[model samples]
Target: MTLRSEFGREGNVWLMPGGSLLSAALAAALVVVGWDVVQLASEEALARAAKEIGPTGRLVLIADTQGRLPDPRAALAGRPRPFVVAVGAGGAFSTLADVVERRVAAAVLDADRPFADLVAALDSLLRSTPVAHDANRLVARLRQREDEARRFFGLTPREQHVLGALIAGRSAAEIAVANQVSMPTVRSHIRAVLTKLGVSSQLAAVALAHRSCREPTLLERMREVHQL
Candidate 1:
């Protein structure tokens, strides 16, 4: 029989050239348990990766030093069980430390390093954690949160922009300058964001926004993959 028939369509479960069949199974098991690597170069790529992996998987995201990274909480909002490892330049890590701390499982900031260093970090992380249990419970909780966030904080484009800036810890004056608006206009947008998200202060608004936006779940990802 040919390799295609032996392994089924897409060949995801098949052994690679010069690799053992057992190693393939082990890799598949890691994916199922939500331990995988995602390399990102832009916000769009990060979003795509997040959608593919879902929430329960452990992700080691290697970001290229080019574009802005997505807000980790928003990028991971749809996931039911979220664990992330962010790898990037030192400046990137420092700039995003708060979000990283809140959202990612770990962060490795070594901009000048080679790709081998990233692989080593991922290996160490996988060996540290046991397999996750109680996926169903986590999924249910995630679904509830998703519903609530969508209902309460479904923001407009402008609001989303404002929210993004707020989460990045920009001041009202800075937001005004960046968006080419008056400080009063920025404050108004901030108030609107707070009202829509049902929060009291700018910090609370940022926190709510972080917790609300996320990519698709694993089941959703599977459906997309199968359809493709």
Candidate 2:
């Protein structure tokens, strides 16, 4: 991603893709609300920025959707910055539910709404509390749960990848294509994951993976933004 805009300020508000009119409008709205905006244009730029931001100052990222940008949660890893995800009304619950469970995004907003609504949400989030503190605690717990699950399952790297694909709703054929492997090889990996996870079906395996983390903490400052 390329940096499309910048302002001399301690805090930063990042827009994943700033070229679109909607993103531009949101960036302007954030600036109006006293947030110095850094608009990222592409996935590369987003990835670069995610790694470059240090663990100081206030940082908030606004992503149109999880799919449009790189995994900020993974990229930020130990940094634990706050994220605002804009998802469609129909898919908001499912998407935000996953975000909450993964501790990826601190807030969710309706993409169908006007930019003003998002600005209002951000304003509330910025004023409530320090989101990074809660986010860091939540993420640390998530990591522990994930590590425990990995150890208990004893899944190899390939098997873990297969399980992740299953959780993502990828068909065996799609997984094979993505991994550049034969259908039979992909099936073998799937079988290995199922065996290690002690599940009879892919759905069961996915459910078990989701069950690994119980009671993931939602960022306190964003409780009023989007209810899942």
Best by TM-score: 2
lDDT of 1 by residue, 1-228 (tens): 012222333211111111223233334443444444233334455555565555545544443335233445555566554455444442343333443444443433332233344345544655555344354453355445546456333666687777766666678899999879998888888888788777789998655544444322322322333355
Point out where model 1 deviates above 4 Å.
1-140, 151-153, 215-228
> For candidate 2, lDDT tens digit of each residue in 1-228?
223334434256666566666667777766666667777766567657765555442344344544342246555656536545533231233444456556556655444333467678766665555454464455455455455345324776677667666666789999999989999999999888777766789888766655451211211112222332
Q: What are the models' TM-scores?
A: 0.37, 0.44
Could you tell me the lDDT of residue 212 within candidate 2?
54
lDDT of each: 0.48, 0.56
Query: All candidates: CA RMSD in angstroms?
Result: 16.8, 14.2
Pairs that clash in candidate 1: 34-57, 34-58, 55-79, 55-81, 77-213, 77-214, 78-214
Poorest lDDT segment (10 consecutive residues) of candidate 1: 10-19
Model 2 poorest ten-residue lDDT run: 213-222
Give one clash count per candidate, in the order shown: 7, 2
The collision pairs in model 2 are 1-44, 1-45
